[model samples]
Target: MEIRAIDHIELFVEDAEEPAAHLRDGFGFALAGRGGAGTGLRGCESVLLRQGGITLLLTAATSADHRAAEYVRQHGDGVGVIGLLVDDAQAAFAEAVERGAVPVAPPETVGPDGARVVFASVEGFGDVEHRFVSRENRAGPFAPFIEETGCGRGGGGLLKTVDHFAICVPAGTLDATVHHYREVFGLSQTFEERIVVGGQAMDSKVVQSASERFTLTVIEPDTSRDPGQIDAFLAAHDGAGVQHVAFLTDDITTAVRTGGERGVRFLSTPESYYDMLTPRLGQVGVPVDELRELNILADRDHAGVMLQIFTESRHPRGTLFYELIDRRGARTFGSNNIQALYEAVARQQAARPAGLD
Candidate 1:
């Protein structure tokens, strides 16, 4: 199966307009489109914003009975859908369904421009859902209802398009979820590791297509080690779901520093983590002081080095966060940074009880 890069990330927000404004004003995205109707999507509204080929769909439920509302109620304002672009939508949907994927929406023709879109979802590593979207350009502003607008802002100040999403699942479900990606989506494991640092551990698997696109990193804590954020997310979210989204950047140091100055809080890595960076990633180009000051982390695999950092969860529900990644030639997730972030989040969670008024 040849899966392209991420098609789009759909989010269920408490107020679609608010987050949409934040993305537009804060991150510099253009409003790609908008949608809603008296049909099955009654009392609901959706806004699409785009920047660097990444579409952030923000949606909200206007009615109490709306599914969006129900999702927010269940998971808080978090990721509701992950759309993947495939060469063949029908074929992908059929393949997934044949392999036990639940059909959320059958292939249907929508829009006056005669575009055909087929979407179906399956249970992902957690409460997360995979939505496969197939499109053939037969559309009006991407969809029938969405009217295109000059919504994209921050054109010169944005990062590159979305690369892929890194999702955290329940502990012990790592292997099974990896199998789910392999069998259901015909994806193959690209990377695998059990990362341990600061006495924290997590098992992760990266799944991708033969084409090298459409990658997703599935992470689960190692129960044998100790309880951590993954366990807390599992308990709070009630199942598997997207944990954080990684935004790829050409220059990670600048990105992290800018994001930090702009009020984006990244999980801090222990100063000791840097003490061993020279030994672990001696060949990495960035300086250790730069990495420490920018709060970016560097790690290496046999292939090359990668830099990454996690943003603090901004959602009130403690779900859905962002990651800034600069993959210098490495195609793998920052395994070494996993435990750093896990411990960082654990400390934050621990202090929350005391910080709350």
Candidate 2:
């Protein structure tokens, strides 16, 4: 039952090339490998992109009966599988199922001798599934069927690893979702908070593995108060799903600059947010002027200061987005910035076209 780290994340899209190219051109991810019917992966095509320690697999179904097709039809292009690296896939899968997790797939071994890998799956939140992967024999590529293409590596070491996943569930499912992760996966609840913005409010909790390499921020809207962006996300997305994925970097200023030059659009913070920065968080690591210019938000916890920014959702459904975060000794999530983020997202939702939803 020892989960090591996140192996990779698999996204189900209508056309793998579209999102793969977007990540390559916009985020500096390199096309590392590919697989499809020719590689014995029936009914779906996959493109693997990698930058630093992050690996993203974009998959699109070619036939009507494939799971990818169903996922795309239901949730649009979004995360379908979160691969977790484990010491033993069989044991991990068994332990998870025994802990009341719904089983998706049994453990199966593949690849040649000396480079074999074992994989199993269990149902996660909504349509997302957790794939338990054990690469005891790491002699070959990520998978036996994938063919490496050696595309030019980009990003210039900007992003290091996945900081966390921000997930949005239904109104009453927040506590149950948190309890499921704690009981089924042995993840600990690290943080929790209730954020109220104007007339709307929402509850959130953070769960992480023992190693702290993996984290999930589970959020639920306050339906009784007023309908907000979280409610809009649930309705448009059709169910619970990943709202955004945060990437960790050593220097967020440079990351934001590079991403902007690559045509990545980030959410903007009002000048008033920085006008009171000195009084709110005191002197910060990054200059207030630079932060204001980049529209990056900064906050300080008891540990240290952290800088973060969110990207505008470009998804057709406006359900998924990305986040870039730079943690300078800060251990907790940006609790103080919760209200700011909530307000910013509320503005974005308000500005959307009348019929886009």
Candidate 3:
């Protein structure tokens, strides 16, 4: 399977209007469109939002019986569906089924304008779902629901577009999930690492197709030390769910500065970590002084180098968040950044009030 880039991500939310406004006012995403039909979906609406090439579909259930409503009730507010763009939706569906991917829906087509879209989903890790989409005619907005409004000018220097997302799976399932992708989508596991951070450990693997657009990093934390967040996510979600969405930018310093100006909270790397930079980079090409000033973390394997930083989760659900990454020529996630992020997040978690009824 030659999977293309990510098409879009659908989030099952409690109230679309409020969150949509947050994205608009806070992150600069515009309302692209909406959707609902007479098929018991009259009240339910899907809001389309875009930043550069990335698209987010936020759907809210108006009635109790709506499937979106059920998803919210069972999993709280989190990512429910991830759409993967493929050259042929029908062929992708057929291949997945033949490779033992459980079918969530048969290939379905709906057309309003001269354009047409064929989509089908297969069960993915945890309670989440993956939809395969093939668009034809390329008319109207994404799907029939959205109204197709522009997302407006960039705010806080948002970069080129949304790139890819990183999701966490259960511990010990890394290899198994990698195999699943290989058998079902013909994806190849291009990178692997066991990252140790702040006395915590996580195993990760990257799977990609020929086009490079369809890249996904799967992570699973070592559970023996403590009931790590990855395990908690799996337990709560009843399987694997999206952990974080990574946004790409040509220049991360501008994006960070702009996002910070707009009040987007980014995780902080300790000042102490900078002391080791002189020995770590040695004669590496990146300007160490510049990296230190920006607080961007870098590391390299045989393939190449990657720079990455994470933003704090803004949602009350504590499930979905963002990653601002600059890949350069590297295909691997920055391992040096892992421990820094883990410690920062642990501090945030510790500050929150504990105990809930």
Candidate 4:
């Protein structure tokens, strides 16, 4: 059960082409490959998008009997599979199932000797599944059926890798979810905290693999407190799911500016947040003026500083979004900025028309 890294994420959508274009045009992801009925993949079509170390497979069902169709119908377009790169897919699958994980797909292997790949699936939180993958060739096509589009080298160098995933679960399920990952996947709890913004509150726990390459911030709403965006997400999404995916970057200023020019709208921060910056966290690496202009928030830990910003979700259900994070020697997530992010999202929710959420 040695998880190397996050291999790739599969998103189930109604139409793959629409979201594929958004990632390509707005977020600098390049078209890497495709698969459909013509390629022997019956009942569904998929588009493969790649950045530096991130691969996103967008799949849409062409028939009613496909699993993607039912997933989209219930939860809307969202993360369906979290592919975990493992040392041995067969062993991982066996271990997970032996530890009480419900198996979704049996082990399947393909390709020739030097380029062989094995895949297996187990049920994760809610409707999402964890696909264990082991590949002998790192640079080959993602899957046997996907046809390479010759754009494999076209990734922009802005975003490096996936930093972590923010997941929202039911109120009483937080501890159980953390325990499941710990016992089944061998992940350890790295951090935990309870965040309270005004009267609304939520609890969160961070879990990471041994290599620290895969991380998940599992959050749950405080049922006794006022209703908030996390509650709205469960209602609109019909269940627990991924809230946002954080992408790590090298430069905050350049990444935010480039993303903005490419039609990525980020959430705004109040001027008052920056007005107290000088007295709060003194002398950050990035200029306060630039951070203010981009509406980026900064936080510091014992290790170093990290700058981050959230994108305005364009999803019709407002359940999924993305995050751009620049960690300058910072080992921890932006804990101090959590309240700022919560307040910003609360403002957005408040501004929406009545009953829209």
| TM-score leader | 4
lDDT of 2 by residue, 209-258 (tens): 99898899999999999888889889989999999999999999999999
Predicted candidate 4 versus true structure: per-residue lDDT over 163-259, tens digit per residue: 9999999989999999999999999999999888788888999999999999999999998999877888898899889999999999878988988
Q: Is candidate 3 or candidate 4 better by TM-score?
A: 4
RMSD of 3: 3.0
Model 2, position 295, has a per-residue lDDT of 92
Q: Which residues of candidate 4, in runs, are more than 4 Å off?
A: 153-155, 353-356
Error of 1 at 326 (Å): 0.7
Q: How far is candidate 4 from the true structure (C-alpha RMSD, Å)?
A: 1.4
Estimate the TM-score for candidate 3: 0.88
Candidate 1, run of 10 with poorest lDDT? 137-146
Residue 196 in candidate 3 has what lDDT? 67
Once fitted onto the true fold, the runs of candidate 2 whose alpha carbons sit more than 4 angstroms away are: 138-140, 151-156
Which ten contiguous residues of candidate 2 have the minimum total lDDT?
Answer: 148-157
Clashes of each: 15, 0, 10, 0
Tell me the tens digit of each residue's lDDT in model 3 across 87-136.
78989999999999999999987766467888899987766788999887
- Candidate 3 ranges with C-alpha deviation above 4 Å: 37-43, 138-140, 150-157, 235-238, 282-294, 301-304
Name the lDDT of candidate 3.
0.74
TM-scores of all candidate predictions against the true structure:
0.88, 0.96, 0.88, 0.97
The TM-score between candidate 2 and the true structure equals 0.96
